[model samples]
Target: MSDTTSTTADRKLTEGTALPTQPCSVVWSDGRAFVLEPPVWVGLDHRGRLARLTPAALQRQGWSHDKLS
Candidate 1:
């Protein structure tokens, strides 16, 4: 049982450390939706408008942690 628990814990840690490489979806506070593609981090709005935001812009908008798989 102890070995099983250790294995489970290790598996959880490995899974938690992995970052997603695919495009993630995010929704702003004003009901606007966007899809953030990685590598370039370009945002595509709900209306199909493309907007490229820098890290500072993203931080200012407070969308640094709302990525959905």
Candidate 2:
């Protein structure tokens, strides 16, 4: 028989540790989705939060406030 009890230290995942690369999928805009594969760097921003960047965010710094012709 093997020991089943595990501690927090044993379950912890090291930050920035290199693991087997795999393609990861994400959904956005209700049904729109995409996949990011290996060799792509994945890290958190200064704010330390993960969020999907919307189409409006790609145009300019503040497309929402910018006047459209």
Candidate 3:
């Protein structure tokens, strides 16, 4: 099988590039809402700042992946 792993360089090139928008939301324990773009897993804060949701943070924050169709 061909190597399907993407290198850091490849990721860097695509990082911060806008893909097609698929807007969704996740909530904090305090009920703060964040707008997320799934498949990308990055989001925007209430003030409209970009938020990077790391795996560790997601688990710690009790986030579930709920895709909005």
Candidate 4:
């Protein structure tokens, strides 16, 4: 028998799931738009804009951010 417990890196986000990354929205939560770079963990409020975030905070949050060219 093998115990296949998934690691944080293996976790996927969906309904009822708490996403490690920020969610997308059409409106700005803080009524402002900001550019997000990799290595930053961001959270969005009711609006689409970035509500809160920490730079290079993904490591502590058990997540990794990658930038695609």
Tens-digit per-residue lDDT, 1-69, candidate 2? 111221122123322333333556321111122223443323233355543443233222111111122
Candidate 2 yields a Cα-based lDDT of: 0.28
- Cα-based lDDT for every prediction: 0.43, 0.28, 0.41, 0.31
In model 4, state the lDDT of residue 17.
35
Q: Which digits, one per residue and each the tens of the lDDT, describe model 3 over residues 1-69?
A: 111222233333334543324567553311233445564346555466767765345434433232211
State the lDDT of candidate 1 residue by residue for 1-69, as single tens digits. Answer: 353453344344434232334577453311334445664346565466877765344434434233222
Which candidate leads the pack in TM-score?
Answer: 1
How many residue pairs clash in each candidate at the backbone level? 0, 0, 0, 4
lDDT of 4 by residue, 8-30 (tens): 33222122333343444211112
Pairs in steric clash, model 3: none
Q: What shift in Å separates residue 29 of candidate 4 from its native position after superposition?
A: 18
Candidates 2 and 4 compared: the better one by TM-score is 4
Pairs of residues clashing in candidate 1: none
Highest lDDT, which number?
1
Candidate 1 local Cα displacement, residue 20, angstroms = 10
RMSD (Cα, Å) for all candidates, in order, is 12.8, 17.9, 13.0, 12.4
Could you tell which candidate, 1 or 2, scores higher by TM-score?
A: 1
